[model samples]
Structures are given as C-alpha cells and as structure tokens.
Target: LNIAALLHDVGKIGVYDSSLRKTTRLSNEEILQLKEHPTIGAGIIKRIDFFHDIAPIVRSHHERFDGHGYPDGLANDAIPIESRIICVADAYDAITSKRTYNKPLSPLKAVEEIERNSGTQFDPEVVSALRNALEPNDLPTVQLNEDDFEEFEIPNECDPDYL
Candidate 1:
C-alpha cells in the first residue's frame, strides 16, 4: 500500500507540462484530460507484473465514497481500503501543499475540509483514523517543492541498487 501510495500519481508524467503547471482553473476539456491520469497509472502498473496487485488500487484512488468520482464510480466498501486511505491522504496533501492554482491551506483548515467531506468525498472511517493519527504539529511547515528535490533522498531500501 505504501508503494502504491507513492506511485499512484505516476501517470501525471503523461499529462502535458502546461496542464500540470496551470495556475488557473482547468477548462472542462482540460479537466477531462486530467482525469485520465488514474487509468493511465493503472495501465502503467499493470504492465509490470511486480505491481499487478496494486494496479486496481491505483485506478480507484480518485473515486469518491459517494460514487461521484472519475474513471469509475465505485463507492464505499467497493473501493479498496488502500485506495480509500490514499484518497484521504492525497486530498490532505493537496489541500495543505502549495499548488500551481492555490495557496496551501493551514493544516487545521485542511483537516476541517477533510472532516467536512468525510462521508462524501472520503471514507468516514479513514477520516477518523487520520484525525486520530495526526496532530497539527505532525505536519510539515512547508511543502516539498522542486527546489527541495535535490535534498530528497530515496532511502537505501527503496534503491534497487542497494537490494
């Protein structure tokens, strides 16, 4: 699940740089284009036998608990638990991190937004777990941006050369 979580957004690599870096709202057409990332991610993973087990989880991570999300509309228990967990984490990260389109929300505000969307956009249980697991102090003060990439090390365990 951890590996899946890390790689879930890999498909974004296929998105055009203009779309990925857009600082304004995407057009409806662009939104449609952006929504293909999940499917594209799953396809990429499925092609690798080592990651087959996680492909479905990646594909469904964007699905909302209320069945209104893109690519597929799976709701509630129909969604993989890993995907559910990742969805909440992804949303929290997105909300709390500075993005091209918006300023980062305070951790408190991000948690509030997650709590507000608990039963609809996210799994209520997952939200509860998140609330239970993290205090405001546990969050990073700054989002890791491209400038920080040089300092971000892939742990030895994650480097195939080490294996």
Candidate 2:
C-alpha cells in the first residue's frame, strides 16, 4: 500500500508541464489529458516485476465510489481496497497542500470537504476510517512557502537506469 501510494502519481511524468503548472483554470482538453495520469502511471509500474501486483491499485485510485471517475469508473468493491484508502488520502493531501492553482485549505476544512463528498467522490468506509484516525490536534501542520514549490522535469519515458 505504501508503494502504491508513493507511486500513484508517477504517471504524471507523462503530463505536459504547462498543464500541470497552469495557475488558471484548465481547459477541457487539458483536463482530459491530466486525467490520463493514473493509466500512464499504472503502465509504468507494471513494467517493473516487483510492482506488478499494485498496478491495478494505482490505476483505480481515481475511481469514485459512485462509478463516476476515470480511467475505468470502477465502483464499490470492484475498486481495490488499497486504492480506496489512497483515494481519500490523496484528496486530503491535495486539499491541504498548497498548489499553484489554489491556496492550501485548513485541515478542518479539508476534512469537511472530504466528509461532504463521502459516498460519491470517496468511499464512505474509508472516509469513516480517516475521521476516526484524525484528532483535532494531531492533524499535520507543515508550512511551505513558494520556494518549497519547485519545477523539475520527470522523464517522459520509463527507464530502468533511472529507477
């Protein structure tokens, strides 16, 4: 699960930097292109014999509990449990972490947002687990400035030498 979580966005290496770095709203085309990261990441992970088993989990992390997400729209039990857990974690991090497009949200607000989307954008069970794990004072607090955000090139193609 740890490996899957760490490498879940590895497919983003194939995404155009312009799309990723855009501060304004993404156009429909850019949004479509960005959505392909999971599949791309899964393909790259599958090439490694050790990570083959977790490729499906990586591929399904974006899947919604209500079968509305891509690349495959898997729902409920059809989606891997590990993927479901990662989905909630990923959303939490994305919400709380500063991004070029948006300001960071408070952990409380982030959790509220996640709670509001429960059973649709996320699995209810996973959301429940997250709620149980978090305590008001235990939430992570990391301060990051603009300097913490750096743009580095990720190889467009998978190379064993780089790995």
Candidate 3:
C-alpha cells in the first residue's frame, strides 16, 4: 500500500507531452487527459496483478476531503486512509517540485497552502503528517526549470498554519 502511493504516478512515464509535466496552466481538455494518468496507472498495475490494492489508491489520489474530488466524489471516511495519505503526500511533492506552472515554494510555504486548505482540499490530520514529514532531510533539490540546479534545503519548525 505504501509503495503504491509512492509510485502511483509511474504511468506518467508514458505521457509524451512535455506539457504534461509543464509548470504552467493546463487547458480544460489537457487537464481532462492529464487526470487519466491515474486510470492509466491503474490499467498498467492491473496487468501486473500484484499491485491490485495500489490501483485504487492511485485512482483516488486526487479525491477531495469534502467529496468534491475527481473520478469519484467520495466524501469523509469513504476514502481509505491509505489513499488520503497519498493525496497529501502527492500534493506536497508537486508543490515542492519545480513544475512548469510554479517554482518550489519554501516548505513552510507549501505547508501554509496545505494548512489553508486542510478542511477543504486536504484532511487536517493528513496535513499534520505532511508537515511532520519535513524533517530537515526530505526536501528535494529537484530541477524545476529542468536546467537550473536545485539548492537542497529544509526548514525547521511547523508553519503557523499547522499550529
């Protein structure tokens, strides 16, 4: 289950469009196709068989805390904790990552956004774990521009939003 959430995005390897990985805004149609990566990941995992439990976690990674999420609008505890954990983890990864639409914010900044949306886009408890995971060692110096090198850094203390 843990590994599934960690690697659920592996199917993204198949997307040919660099735009799929761009940090810029996506059009509605592009967003639609982009969302399919979860289902595509499920498909890929299904053929592999051993990862059956991961398929749904992959499929529901974007589901909302208030039943407003995609593929399915499952609300409340209808979502598995395993899935919810990934939802928070995946979001944290993207915000901290250098994508085409945005540069990585400070970890404090990312947690601020997550804490701001906790009861809405994210689970409050899961949000805590998200912030907790930032132990001076997890920040990735990922190449956002795909050219500029990353300066590896992590912050101490939780953003007030988490408090």
Best by TM-score: 2
Better of 1 and 2 by TM-score: 2
lDDT of 1 at 18: 89
| Pairs that collide, model 1 | none
Q: Rank the candidates by lDDT, best first.
A: 2, 1, 3
What lDDT does the true structure give each of the candidates? Answer: 0.89, 0.92, 0.75
What total of clashing residue pairs does each candidate reach?
Answer: 0, 0, 6
Better of 1 and 2 by lDDT: 2
**Candidate 1 — which residues are off by over 4 angstroms?**
136-163
- lDDT by residue (57-115, candidate 1, tens digit) is 99999999999987899999999999999999999999987787887786778888999
lDDT of each residue in 1-163, candidate 3, tens digit only: 6788767787676665864766567777777777777778877877766777678777777789999987678876887787788888788778877667767776667777888989887888999877777754665433345456667756545867545
Q: What is the full ranking by TM-score, best candidate first?
A: 2, 1, 3
Q: Specify the highest-lDDT model's number.
A: 2
The runs of at least 3 residues in candidate 2 whose Cα sits more than 4 Å from the true structure, single-residue gaps closed, are 137-163
For every candidate in turn, the CA RMSD to the true structure comes to 4.6, 5.8, 10.8
* lDDT per residue (tens digit) for residues 84-119 in model 2: 999999999999888898788878778889999999
Candidate 2: worst-modelled 10 consecutive residues by lDDT: 136-145
Choose 1 or 3, whichever is better by TM-score. Answer: 1
